[model samples]
Target: MEIDKVKDPATVKLHSQVEMGSMELKSILGYDDQGLVAAPEKKSSDEAPLKVLYSSGSGSFNRKVMRNTVVHSIRTVVFSSRLNLLMPFGPLAILVQTLTGHHGWVFLLSLLGIIPLAERLGYATEQLACYTGPTVGGLLNATFGNATELIISIYALRNGMIRVVQQSLLGSILSNMLLVLGCAFFAGGLVFSKRPQVFNKPTAAVNSGLLLMAVMGLLLPALLHTTHTELHFGKSALALSRFTSCIMLVAYASYLFFQLKSQRSLYVPVDEGEEIHSDASDDDEEVPEISKWESIIWLTILTAWISILSEYLVNAIEGASVALNIPVAFISVILLPIVGNAAEHAGAVMFAMKDKLDITLGVAIGSSTQISMFGIPFCVMVGWIMGVPMDLNFQLFETATLFITVLVVAFMLQEGTSNYFKGIMLILCYIIVAASFFVHIDPTAIQDKPPETKE
Candidate 1:
């Protein structure tokens, strides 16, 4: 329909910001067409009156386009604002972490520690959380993660700083064995009365077996070297130990290989409502992959910051006790790792809340692996660079605590089932370990031992 009004030379942009709806864009005319441009206001075609009162200029189609444009722009701005906060700090913190090794203590503060390690494990699992059909990727992501963490840890172990490596190893193990698994059992059991959901048989079986092996692997060296670790292994023993670790390593490799195969061949039907995390779901959106370059850059920076600040951390502790009046033991054992791990820990808990059991498990385990691998090795590498031989290793108690924790966790998660009872067991185990740290418990004195117990 054509209008009789003359064209107005002045057309000012007038934007209507609507609440709970898309904004509308209109052009205000100066003189010739001052009133609203009407497109033959028609009564409802079917006489429905209360819905849309009237239709105006160019019908509903033109208004929709304008409305859509405004809405998209508004949403873009809103989303970008949140991303803006992490844009600088997240990457920058990671970069600062990778470069300086102010000693292995950097592992705690440095976000780059795991980010780069995750990228380096590229031949294996990926960074992105897939959100699509089939559980192929999701299954692989979960099961194969152990291999990736092991690869990273091996690199860290070989680099040295036996203590730092050991400490980080202990840290990672405890976090997973106690914290992650415990949370899963606790949360899952608490939420529902039925037994916690289990994964496929083959995958669960392999995972349980590998976890048991890991427990054995960590314990072997400690037990063997308890007498004289300084007596570095001869060629034969070294070869044998390496060969053993290698065989254990091969088991993990087998697990990964089998997982990949299963990913292709197997098609176990998931719960109709079973949300395949990282495999497209109704609840959560997909995880954007971290870029390789960003991973590399941040890892370097994070290393540097951590290394540099460690001396400060050690130095500051002296004054911290004086100022804060906190005990040295509490500050050393609890506060430091907690502070350094704040980010990663949050990441783990977040995964749990999302019901990404695999990720929550992986992060806790990967962290220990990172601490053992990158954290320890980085410290050793830095020490070598500086020509300073640092005595960076954990105490016997720490290692024992970690070993015991993993042992118990392996037993609990062995059946691929978790519940409140299992969670309680984990928590109880953690408590026992903590108490052992403070009090003395000599098993040799009591000749009583439970089955599957850590000797």
Candidate 2:
């Protein structure tokens, strides 16, 4: 005891506890001292300083990521094309609307503004599609590609511009089937002058059949009205139109399921000649410029802006018709569709030039099918909910135009081959349609006038 230095039991216990605590702390801090004489450890660096540095670095990192996202989204969407030059027209249109009563100028400016926006909208959708995979991607393209027209239709519907909605939707189908597809075929043929361009025949046939079905959906209503053979007079025609719309919507849903799920192979892009290697290489090289979330944000912003401009555009239609000395029929049936479809038109032609005829057909014929099968019926349902009397009765002239157009397109696509001659014919057919609309007066316009009293 005298040699070892005896201690009190309580003091020894406390000392042991302190040593145990020190060892645990050292272990947690990754320190070790063994098999040597231990030197006094320098004071551990202050955790406060390290923590402050880490926090600041993390904050800066977050900021950098956010900045990159913004820059990338802007560069991809706003600066991707020369079409962006038209973007200023959006703000200018608003200014013109606010400052003056020049509805024609406002309409023109709004039309120009929407061109870039529509193209960018499609671009954003395509970027998003890269994330969604091909099946959902095709649906996204169809939906957003028609978004401009849909927005305009909604605005028109809200204003009780029923005829405008009908004609505009009809025009969208016509423009896609004729003008966009024609340009695509024409451009592709010129580029591949030595051979004919080919697309997926089954896909084209399916789209053609769907277009014909849509024609029937529209035709029956017009015929019912014109023949005065409705079971309940005026009320019966409206009822039939609503019922038919619901059925058409169901058919479109099934078609989408077929294309996306059951028979997806039918829609795969058909590459021929030298396109196979080039397309494969291009697919490998293709990378999305914007992230998925960024694509979504841009789509929302673009759609909202489109809705705003579409409001202005719809409001200006009647005024612009009077001020510009253009017939309302031509404006609704020809001009509006062309402007709304600028994105689809450009994309179809570009793909065709690359000899990707399958994609071209999807952009053109698929769009026509969507408008007829989905867009028109969806509009009818929307109107029903809104207590608006939107219907499939496109009048005799419009319905007949649609019917013949479908037949012509169906016949042309039956061969599953396209050449510049076929393209020229389609283009000529569209020109004739445009000319007819230019001179044609809307029956609804005349009907809206007060009947004259006998002098």
Candidate 3:
């Protein structure tokens, strides 16, 4: 005789109820039918909340499954771009440093290696932003977008290469405002030759204002040093630099609050035509290629590799300058910024070509604002902690160049419209800046400065 095979009716009903409850719980926890988290969805106020309870084992199992999925996605994230081909340069740079004494080669390799990683870092950040809301995402972009320059500056500061740190930072701002923005304008003008490319004037105005403010902060310290108006000679310039940096940081934070919170509408694209185009483009919208956790992990890994490569690059700066017969100023001001910001430059130009000048401006002008108001000042504070004497006194020539660049950019942005001519002018101006730096000598270069000690 067979055992009773029929299930109790109450038992079958209870099992079905449990399964339904499990599905509801998964949905509430952001999982879809396959137990994978779906793309972020807007919650409706009218939808009833579902309540479900689960044992600890179920929670642990869910976490394990998620962890494994993220692990497998690593390959997708790493091989996502053709740029990974340059990743080998990272190992090559390290190998050159270990096996050879060619500082120039090491420096060149390191620079090439960091290019792809820098771009990938930005890619990862953008992917991660799919999960974080726009405000936080904007902040993340601001931070990581300049991570390369920041990391290099830190390494240079540690080695008492304060001038390198200052010049490189100045170069970043100049590159973004001039080279990147100019290229975007030029590309957009060519692509939309029949009509002028327009962007959010209010947003551009705000960024220009911040750039001018940064210029003022830098100018005063240089002026105090040059005009000998400091109350305490050498110490006064450093003191003012630190104080002004603190104020600038606060101002930047306030600006962030305004942009991301208070007056976000001012930054939104206003052209109805552009809005239609944007909506149409949504059909080709980019979906996140990797999970949020995967993005985070890749970012950490890329940043760490960049940091490692930066150390080698920083150590080779002077050596490379001598071996390559290039001025240290040129290397710092012209070469480094161009390479470090290659990703940003490409992104801005692409947006401009798409007639999305607002995004182009945000990429170019917004980056300049972040570097000037946030990155430079943050470096000053870090240097202060390490007693590196990293002040805002970027020297007379450098300060004048920065001031002129800001003025020129501010003028270009006044109309909130751009053409190839304006783009050409900006590019010519940057060329002048680069050529000037190539010939210019920093009287207070690392070799001339006295050794730094902790205060």
| Residue lDDT tens for model 2, 267-318 | 8866564454566677764577878999889988987887788778878887
Task: Name the runs in model 1 displaced over 4 angstroms.
Answer: 1-127, 131-161, 191-195, 200-202, 227-251, 262-348, 354-400, 438-455
Q: How far is candidate 1 from the true structure (C-alpha RMSD, Å)?
A: 16.1
Model 1 lDDT, residue 418, Cα: 52
Off by over 4 Å in 3: 1-77, 128-139, 271-273, 276-280, 446-455
- Weakest lDDT window of 10 consecutive positions for candidate 3: 446-455
Model 1 lDDT tens row, 1-455: 12322322222112222411231222221112334333333232333443333443445766787688656543432243332343243344345446653322333333333333222222122233343222333433332333322333333344442333344345444655576556656765676445464533444344545555655554555455555543554333333344455465456556546645646344343343255343556433444334334333433443444343333444344344344444334334444444344334444444444444455445554444434433333444444455433222243565566556656655665575555787778767766654553343223221122221432
What C-alpha lDDT do the candidate models reach, one value each? Answer: 0.43, 0.82, 0.80
1 against 3, candidate with superior lDDT: 3
lDDT of 3 at 68: 85
In model 3, residue pairs whose N, Cα or C atoms come closer than 3 Å (at least 3 residues apart or on different chains), thus clashing, are none
- Models sorted by TM-score, best on top: 2, 3, 1
lDDT, residue 162, candidate 1: 36
Q: Give the total clashing residue pairs for model 1.
A: 28
Clash number for every model?
28, 0, 0
Number of the candidate with higher TM-score, 2 or 3: 2
